[model samples]
Target: MVSIFLRSLVYNVLFYVLLVLWMLMAIPTFLLPRRVFMRVAKAWARSSIWLMSAICNIKVEYRGVEKIPNGPLIVASKHQSMWETFALLQFFDAPLFIYKRELGWIPFFGWYLMKSRMIGVDRDGGMRSLMEMARRAPKEIRGGRQLIIFPEGTRTPVDATPNYMTGVGQIYASAGVPCIPVALNSGLFWPRRTFMRYPGTLVVEFLDPLPPGLARKDFIVRIKASIEDATKRLVDAARAEQAQLFGRVPAKT
Candidate 1:
């Protein structure tokens, strides 16, 4: 336990240091095209993944990447940990994220988010905010950008009850694009609300895409079922692996 705690401490410190360095290096991208800045961002994501593996012994496997379609699409992924936010960027050409408006108020980090043209919504704005998101999503989709959103809208602990929001379905119906459901067991290794990073395989599987034009109700049901079922399988598998590594499954907080 002490060894794990020390490793987690080192990993956390290095992760932030690396982030600051990358941010400084990417400053010039602010003047370049959006794609150019996106390349920088992807590189950073890759670096972070590699660092976690090197220092924390966490191996990452991305399955069914070939299943991801080209052109405008919606990537609805399970929200487990903060890992997916940037790790998933490497797979898309033009990836867009819907984030809290307050995050856009941060210093350099927020500035880059604005430069990338990510959608920011006021959580306090109620239905009006959702309507605005629904209206703006299709335009971006038409521009050939992949909108990556978490159906649950926030990260949930491993084995927690699924609480998918209806807003993703609204955006999907309006965007008129196939939605790829992604399932990952990231919370097992990178549990939220804590600094500990565990050693184990972190798997992200891209399930089959739900075709465009389904009724909003049906779309929501299908996406939720697909993501939750696949996520359960992943979490179970990772728990077994953790047990083998540590003589017991670590309790997820």
Candidate 2:
């Protein structure tokens, strides 16, 4: 526990300093010729992962990396830890994210996010805001960039049955493109709002895409089932791996 605190403190300092520097020069990096911003951004994220590994000893064991694409795809990911955001940024180039509006107010990180043109949905307002998100999302997908949406909406329960939201279904219906359901167990080590990152592997599983034959409303159950099923599989995998690594004797594989 003492080691975790020390490591977290050191990583926080390094990350904050890097974030400040990243924000100050982000615009030019993003606007420069040849669209080399993605190159710089990927390098930055790779370094972030390296720093986290060195400081916290948190090893990420991701799978299905080949499924990531350059074309417009709706990435329906299981929501758990916030760690995947950095992984996504590093792996994919400027893929638009659908997060709450309030998160945009976060200090240096939010500034860089805004300048990068990531999308934020207002979760507090009434139905109008919801409609706007549903409305705007399809257009973004149509524009050739992929999207990363947490099917559970917000983060899921740390140790309870998982339930996915209907918005992901609605988006799949409207977007009319292949939506990949990805299952991740990032929360196992990097629990939400917690500074202590346990040394373990984080698994990201890319499940099969939604049925291309189905229409919008058909996705209501189809997509939900897909995400929930995959989430369990991924979570189970992470739990098993964590048990073996830490000598905790897991429940089941």
Candidate 3:
């Protein structure tokens, strides 16, 4: 426990230090083309991942790069930990996220989101807000940016009951693009709302793509099943490995 706390403290301190510096350095990116700004954003993510590995003793390994299509698509990923927010950015070309409208109000971070031209959804604005999201999403798709959305709407702990939402289906129906379901066991290592980072490999698997033109109902069912089932397997596998090594499953810290 002492070792974990010390490592977490070092990782947390360095992570924020790098984050503040990166944000200040990236202010110039706002004046450049969006693509160039995104390249800088990916660099920041890479640096953060490196810090996590070097200091926190955590590493991320993902597969299924070939499964990602060349054209515009929807990357409907499992929301586990916050790690995927930036880690997944490096894999897609011009990826746009569907975030809460209020998040765009943050200082430099929000400015970064605006410059990236991400899709913002007004979750509390009722059906009208959703309709607006549906309407605006197609423009991003037409621009050839991959849309990364969490089907669960929020991060879920490992092995928790899934709360897959229909909003993702709405996006898919409106965007008219294939949905690539990505499953990961990141919560096992990084967790949500926690400072203790575990020493382990985080596995992110990109499942087969759900092709466009399916009925909304069918698309929702397929994506939920694909992501949930794969995510459960990852969570279970990680737990088993942890039990084997530690003589008991390690709880998220």
Candidate 1: tens digits of C-alpha lDDT, residues 63-135: 9999999999999999889999999999999999999999999999999999999999999999899899889
Tell me the spans in candidate 1 whose CA falls farther than 4 Å from its real position.
none
- Lowest lDDT 10-residue stretch of candidate 2: 244-253
Q: For all the candidates, what are their Cα RMSDs to the real structure? A: 0.7, 3.2, 1.4
TM-score of 1: 0.99
**Candidate 2 runs further than 4 Å off:** 30-38, 105-108, 217-220, 249-253
| TM-score of candidate 3 versus the correct structure, residues matched by position | 0.95
Residues 95-190 of candidate 3 have per-residue lDDT tens digits of: 888889899899998888999999777789998988888888877886798988888889888777888888788778888888899999999888
What is the number of residue pairs that collide in model 3?
0
Report the number of the highest-TM-score candidate.
1
Q: RMSD of model 2, in Å?
A: 3.2
Residue 6's lDDT in candidate 3: 95
Error of 1 at 15 (Å): 0.6
Candidates by TM-score, descending order: 1, 3, 2
Please list the C-alpha lDDT of all candidates, in the order they appear: 0.93, 0.71, 0.86
Instruction: Give, for candidate 3, the lowest lDDT window spanning 10 residues.
Output: 244-253
**Higher-lDDT candidate of 1 and 3:** 1
How far is 94's C-alpha from truth in model 3 (Å)?
Answer: 0.6
TM-score-better candidate, 1 vs 2: 1
